[model samples]
Target chain A: MKESLVIQANNLSKKYRLGTIGMTSLREDLSRWWTRSKNGIPKHGFDQAGIDPTRMINDHEFWALHDLNFEITRGEVVGLIGANGSGKSTLLKILSRITEPSEGKVKVKGKVASLLEVGTGFHPELTGRENVFVNGAILGMTRREVDKKFDEIVDFAGVADFIDTPIKRYSSGMTVRLGFAVAAHLEPDILIVDEVLAVGDLRFQNRCINQMKSIAESGKTVLFVSHQMATVENLCKSAFLLNMGQIIYSGKTSDVIKKYREDMEESANLPISQRMIREGSGKCKLSGIEFRNDQNKVVDSLISGKSATIKLFFDIYEEITAPMSLSLGISNSTHVRIAHLCMKTFGKWILPTSQKSFQVNLSLSKLELNQGKYYVTSFLDDESGQIIDWVTDAFVINVLQSDFYGTGMVPPTSQSIFLMDHSFSF
Target chain B: MQKQSITVLKPSAGWTGFDFAGIWQYRDLLYLLVRRDFLAQYKQTILGPAWFVLQPLFLTVVFTLIFGKFAQIPTEGLPPLLFYNSGLIIWSYFSHCFTGNASVFTANAGIYQKVYYPRLINPLANCVSGLLGFSVQALFFVGYFCVYKIFIPTASHFEMTSAMLTIPLLIPLVASLGLGMGLWMSVLTAKYRDFNQITGFLAQALMYATPIIYPLSEVPEQYRFWASLNPMASVVESFRFALLGKGSFSFHLLCYSTIVAVLLLLSGIYFFKRTERRVVDYL
Candidate 1:
């Protein structure tokens, strides 16, 4: 016998207007009421009428999730993977009934418990013991159920010693741990986790993941959202890859990962200016930034320990040749800077010409950056120590894993970066 | 784990009604929240629950001195202390409930954003907790009445009737009115936020508009129609009549206030439910 699916979302979409004032006043109320009334009954399978032409020009309306369709069978652990702003959180919010969709409909069975953020149900003034029952209730567990699971939750959170202490006094990690324990023990039919495990220490993170795994194994459908691809691969058999508010790929975890990697590579090929860069303080003026491989074709791909150059074209608006220096730093997707290179100690090259546009290329025999998303930042400084220009995030690049480096190390070195040589004779 | 005992199932589509059953299921959570509010409010305070009694006692003395002794406002033949204290007790309960419910969304926006709960529970729990505070204050009124009856018996006349039993019924009515207005204002404040600043002023204006400091009969007869139109005016008068058995309690006014309370409460819940899911988007 085939098991029935727990959730079925058909052509679901959500649209939000940008930078508009929210509901207020009797005038806006009457207008909104009229609009909602004239649009006909908002129900599943009905097409939403177009926005009123009489209204002022809206800056823009973007679909957070667009034309998505999927089904999840009971007890399936489905991982939702996407880059930032890819609508993973939006989808989860809709599933958890925290918000309604702009279009389409979703059908869910049984009670749903969503841990969109750890410690969401906790009140700062309430004690740890009080929060357990309160949060458990917020997640749909009955009082007797909380009582039955109270001890188990306290033990799981390791907060029995401070159970009577107010949550306001608890550290953030402790709060998150206790919050997760309450949600985990509630035993809902469907569990929604959205990057909450990233809050605590490694041990707590491991415990949360294991709890989720056990939850899925206990015949409950689980929808897990995370940027941690390895964790997704290890836990979820099925995966959905979201890109630009659309489902780009949905299938077995391996296939989705492959498609996601390919899509990342395609995005990497785009010019740094055309690619999305988070709004940054443009203190330092950057004229030109390019990534080029050995053939000098401005290719996106780079081989570990192979020759590559970051050609930085700059213009010095204010003339100061006082040991002016250039520095470049690379950062991962989480914006953690992994490596840095500076021209201060290397000595600055004199401008061949006083023209506004000039080029400086940094050559590397081997790229020691790991295989993942990387962004580069360049800074301009005076040798006299008075910094002239500083650009925090200038360009982004993707460093793909190559056969030479293997999965763990860069530059294919026999000895690690620590340069340790060990012979175990136990 | 046990062999997949329950088969996979999907949630039903379409507009769903308020889940009363779900709210009932979370009753324990509601109690926990109520308990937390009760304990936490007086936790660090020096006087603790004594503050509850002192507030009304002090306010009653002040009101008696100003309205009774100075202005010589008529109290419909009740002792000045008994008259003023009755008004203060009822008004305090109403004001506390209104303020508490009105700040529900703004105060709890952090938790509202993170988890999904029946948003109704926030206001409901607040009303329940406010009732507890009101009860503590009501005990003070009883203490003062006992002293008045014993020490100053000839200063006032007192009587008890079955109409006094109707006092308990007014609890739900007063709660619903406060909750209704509170939720409506709470949702609006979430969007405009200016309402938060203005609410204190509005509540003060409402207090003066109601017969909290003076008797309903003290208002000019021409303005009595307008004063009685205020829903809370009838509520405060009814509460006074129930406790002191002196103020006016028109059955027609009671019916009208009850109707208004019901309408406000329902509309408040409707607007609150509509805004609950989307409030987080703005917050």
Candidate 2:
């Protein structure tokens, strides 16, 4: 324990049984209890170590978080960056007391408020004014505290005229704004947020960022988790990168984000067939994917306003006369989808022959995507709307900048992910 | 310098980790939850809050027809309406408290998974909110009893007895038994979902097991011991004797039910506190 440190974790770990967590039947519990009583109960869990992977696969037990140790000092705004299932959420759950850790401990000084979600306990039947008090109390604020900040919250949400109406009638955007407003007014010693900024419009997002900045400036601690690296870069000074239930890097936010990018690139380098992260039935599968320039030479990156072609190689196991549709989406580093190309929208479908394998080429005369790192997600669906194959973050395509308007200038990628083809008449 | 409080969270709180103070700190939330339950139930309906009184009133009349008039069940010489209303009044409180809290973990898993608060607050709120309906029905019962004794003819055997002094004491007895059993059932129902389907059936069977529609004197002496083990049996009978002054009452039976209530309350708190810490993981 240190004088300035507000939160500390020592060897914290959480083990989750993959399926059928506990006894589902009294007969099973009874038999197990009888055996344990006769053979003497075995001491297991928590302190148990050296679990083999094969045994874990068989027994359906795995540690979601393993021996995580970190500390946050007062007034520090830290970002936790990790891919899906990298244990960021488990750590947050343990910190928020929503779920207990399997081993070790986490200590915090002063009161802590965790907003794992906005409108955590809102009732649709309750009015906006009533829901505000309920949501505030669920976030650990007292009745008098909510009363003191009621006017400010309503003003911030900008729903003064409809405060007495049931939130069920409010638009989804209005509900989100009011929910975020109540959460933002909580004055706890420490605040933990998880992807709540992914909601609301751009204007409200900016308001939320400003409110977070003011909270940090007031010497309160914040531990934020998000998939959006741009927001992390803007809000956090230091960050931690987690991979496979362990902290791989911890340093300046910029350096950590670079490490995250490198991690994504490394995963993208693997051959498509060998990647473990995929979904849908295996009737048809993506065998390979490649990007090529206008000259038909294979390239890893495409330049804006230049002709390029994307080739998708599929392997079909059982063929029929059913028509199938193909879709490819490109998303920026912030995980926001920027471009989508679907065959069904154009009223065109593919009828695969008896061939076990085939290649489909999508040629673009001029790339409209802005200059940035983008990830590709591919989906294949049949006539019945059943997904044949779906892969996310299947590959990465780097888009380079070009002057579409021949002005030798371009807008920042942050302004928009698409560069429109236009000319100045004035 | 401002004084700071440090909290250290561990894997488990062990057997002795009863958090009475934690529940006390979240008392405001408990009150708000109770208010929400009371206000939110009858919304968007024509008869708002009137259903509170009408529900028990309708049940009492139905029971008076089937069990009193048709089946010829004895009410220990009291009017059938007064007898049935007396039983339904206390029975509904216990049943509401029990069944309302029985599925607490499964019903509120959404909130419990994302927030941190005393899990006991949910069931405790249900108990308190059950009182709102109980008081309304109790008032109706008192008015009906007055109508029978003073207004209705051929009903002159009713007299308020000294046992009526213990009427206020019956509230906690019923509340604790219901909450205790409900807490235990919450854990069981969360563990085995099929158990949830039978809770309503069990509550109905339990009502018949106790002397709700009939007097305790009707049960044979051989089965009275097993009947007294129900915990609610003595409470319901004592409520009848206290209010209408014409039902069975025994000191030993009352003492026995009191002990069961105390034990159930203590053990229910212990088991609920232990289960709630990690209930969300499995749920």
Candidate 3:
């Protein structure tokens, strides 16, 4: 353990059963208990030496987190960046005492508070005024402490006028403001925030970020988790980049972010339909997807300022009496939707009901995105906005380094999402 | 001046995580949980908290009809209203406390998942707030006692004495038993949720087995030992005796039940702390 460390950890791990709670009967649960006690968990992933994908995994168990170690010193701002289910939430849970680590220990020498999300304890039925008390209590604030900071919290949330209104009636943004305000005002020696910035509009996001910066500046040890690489790079001095429940990189935030992007790009070459995680109503299915150039050539990489085309192939099993629109969204690595194209807005005809497979092509006159890798999400919905199918992060596409203005200044991905046409007259 | 410091042990600390000081530190949370449960139960209803009293009061009437009027079950010569209402008072409290504590984990899963606190605070609050609800039923029972006192016009109807002072003793006896049994059931229910249905059924069936519907003397000699196995049987019996100076009394049985209650409570706390570290993930 380092001398200034507030948290020290050894080989921390956690295991989870395959079946969800209550889905298994008592007899099956007892059997799982037997298997667990007997150490019958199958050696999967990193636990096994060689990559054996077909080794008949019979243990019905998986490790959400494996042997990984890190230390956090007092007043250190550490960032955890990983894809979905990369064990980021599990790590935070173990740190916050919401779950136990199966294989190791963590010694924390401070009063810790984990802001799981905005409104972690807010009751919809409680008025904003009363919820102030209840949410404050849930966050480990004494009533007197809440009373002392009551005015500041209200003013920070900007809900003084509707303080007595039931939180259920408060707009979603209002509730988040109040929730974040209460959490920021608390005086915990250690704070852990997870994915809270992903919510709310950009203005509120900036306000929350400023509030967090002040918390960090006040000499509190903070562990923050977010998918926003830009935010993480701006805030954290040290960071841990995890993949498949193991710490692949740890050090300066910029280096960790690079490691994360490289890991994402490693799997970029697979035909997305084979690699992407698919989930939705499945009323219709994304049978195939491809990106194309103006020459009508299917490709995976695009150059900025080119006329790009997105082609989606779908299979409709059932008859559609009304028109069903398709939507395509492109998001950068930050998990924020950068651009959206809906079929309804683009195509004006009410297509008749039919049961068949079809291909819809969308052509963009100019792809203005900066040089970066982006993922595609597709959605199909009926005229009434009933989602027939949605495949989030269904495909990965690379936007290559091209001079959009015919000048040599090929803007980097970090410059901006947009590359504008410009002339230098000076 | 020396500065105070705090330390958080990792989850794998296991048994060393036992800290009564932690529970004491979160006393306000316990109070808030109790207040929330009590108030939230009665809100939005036209009758509100009155149902707390009207519930047992009405049940007492029905019991008086079935056991007292129809069956003519001897109440050891005490007026039936006084006898039945006395049992109802304690039974209502115990069952209420027991049912709430038994499901405390699943019911407050939302709060527990997000925040870290001494999990025992939930059940402890349920027990205390249950007492408050019982006090209301106790008021209604006193009303029943007054009505019987006027109608029967006999010392046999009811009389207060030093025996009544044992009430303070009787309450925790019944409450601790409920808390103990309920906490034990909560742990079991967390792993095997079928224990939840069993807990519900047994809580109801327990009233029947506790001599609430029949006097302890009438339980047929052969079944007496098994019937008295219910710790609450003595708790309710003694509560009646303390109030009306009637019904059976045995110091040894009280001692036995008290020992059983304390053992269950300690073990319940022990297992609950053991499960607290991992149960949230399962939920």
Best by DockQ: 2
Of all true interface contacts, what fraction is found in model 1? 0.40
Tell how far residue B45 is off in model 2, in angstroms: 2.3
Instruction: Rate residue B66 of model 3 by lDDT.
Output: 91
What does candidate 2's lDDT look like per residue over B62-112, in tens digits?
999999999999899898888889899899999988899889999999999
Q: Is the docking of candidate 3 incorrect, acceptable, medium or high quality?
A: acceptable
Whose lDDT is greatest here? 2
Please tell me which predicted candidate would have the highest TM-score against the true structure. 2
Docking class of 2: medium
Off by over 4 Å in 2: A20-58, A276-329, A333-337, A340-367, A370-373, A377-392, A398-426
True contacts kept of each: 0.40, 0.69, 0.39
Question: Please, what are the lDDT tens digits per residue for candidate 2 over residues A156-267?
Answer: 9999999999899999999999999999999989999999998999999999999988888888999999888888888999999987677889999999999988887787
Give the candidates in order of lDDT, highest first. Answer: 2, 3, 1
- DockQ, in order, for the candidates? 0.36, 0.66, 0.38
lDDT of 1 by residue, B1-283 (tens): 3333332222234334566975786777788788878777887689987887887888889988998899988888888888888887787777877887887777888777667777888888888888887898788788888888889878658754456777887778888788888988898787776788778988899989999778888899999999999988988888888887777777888889889999998888877877775776767
In model 3, pairs of residues that clash are none
Isolated chain A: TM-score per model? 0.67, 0.76, 0.74
Candidate 1 achieves a global lDDT of 0.74
Better of 1 and 2 by DockQ: 2
